[model samples]
Target: MRGCRYQACRHEPLVVVYEDNVVDRNKKRWRRNNEELPVHLRRPEVVRPSRPLSVDQWNQFAWESSQASLVPCENCGRTFAPDRLEVHQRSCKTPLPGAPRKLALQQVN
Candidate 1:
């Protein structure tokens, strides 16, 4: 077989892991929902079930997030959410040297 590229079986059932040190294939993509995981493993970006915040703090977060979403991409000059920026950047085709990437980013940011 030339360059046999068989990926791991995805149909297999996900297994719950307790130990942090041990490498569990299932837990690599997502942490166990029911049980507590390591500090690093927990995704802090998730807003739901997060710590309580003051009205001011919530308002600031909302405004800042909205502003960030409106910021345009340096390469494409099209606005996209911060999370989608990385994906868009990958597919976006950068123009020739004559086209200014820095200027667009500066104006948007």
Candidate 2:
């Protein structure tokens, strides 16, 4: 006769329980509690740097080389390194050639 073979199969039925919902509920409750607290009492947020902490010297060299191209100033037409372009542009008094002229206000007669 081919009946039940496993020994523990007749024991208490096994049940699977998932704790995902419980964890999510707990997180929501914690966040709500923190939000209710005053700013001074709340924990400070962590700050992270945007760039990598330790860049290799070779990688740094490659990055500088890639960005080393000179950019022409729109006002003076003079080329400056990408990093210095902004500083040069700020002090450049020469206006762009053939640029539209500003209209002068006419005085009342």
Candidate 3:
């Protein structure tokens, strides 16, 4: 029988017997009672889906892709040299309201 994936689950097989039925020993592990439980109930750390981008947003990305290295970040709209572009892309702290945080998240491990 396959054990439960959860570290907390101490679940064991439930043995059921019928009066007129012959035991089907060939059958494997029984299904868990909580198999149909909601995902939130099963896993606590669920990430929500991000909002969908509009057609204009896609067009902007496409336009940016066609541009040369002389182009700057769409968020900051500051032109930078090709060599400096990657570094600037990672560290630029533009004051734009909707712009994503410039700094990447530090990995704990």
TM-scores for all candidates: the values are 0.31, 0.26, 0.23
For residue 80, what is the lDDT in candidate 2? 57
**Residue-by-residue lDDT tens digits, candidate 2, 10-43:** 4334321235566567767756765776453343
- What is the lDDT for 105 in model 2? 10
What are the per-residue Cα lDDT tens digits for candidate 3 across 1-109? 5555743353332222442133332221111312344332221222222666688976666555434224345446665544455678788665667655333221111
> How many residue pairs of model 3 clash at the backbone?
0
The CA lDDT of each predicted structure is 0.55, 0.51, 0.42
Instruction: Highest lDDT: give the candidate number.
Output: 1
Off by over 4 Å in 1: 1-65, 100-104
Instruction: Indicate the worst ten consecutive residues by lDDT in candidate 2.
Output: 100-109
| Best model number under TM-score | 1
**Residue lDDT tens for model 1, 1-109:** 4343332342232232333335454444434541354342233332422688799988888876566435467676776654466678899898787775655466745
Best of the two (1, 2) by lDDT: 1
Score residue 106 of candidate 1 by CA lDDT.
68
Q: Rank the candidates by TM-score, best first.
A: 1, 2, 3
Q: What is the lDDT of residue 5 in candidate 2?
A: 58
TM-score of 3: 0.23
Model 2: residues with Cα > 4 Å off, grouped in runs: 1-68, 94-109
User: Ten-residue segment with the worst summed lDDT in candidate 1?
Assistant: 7-16
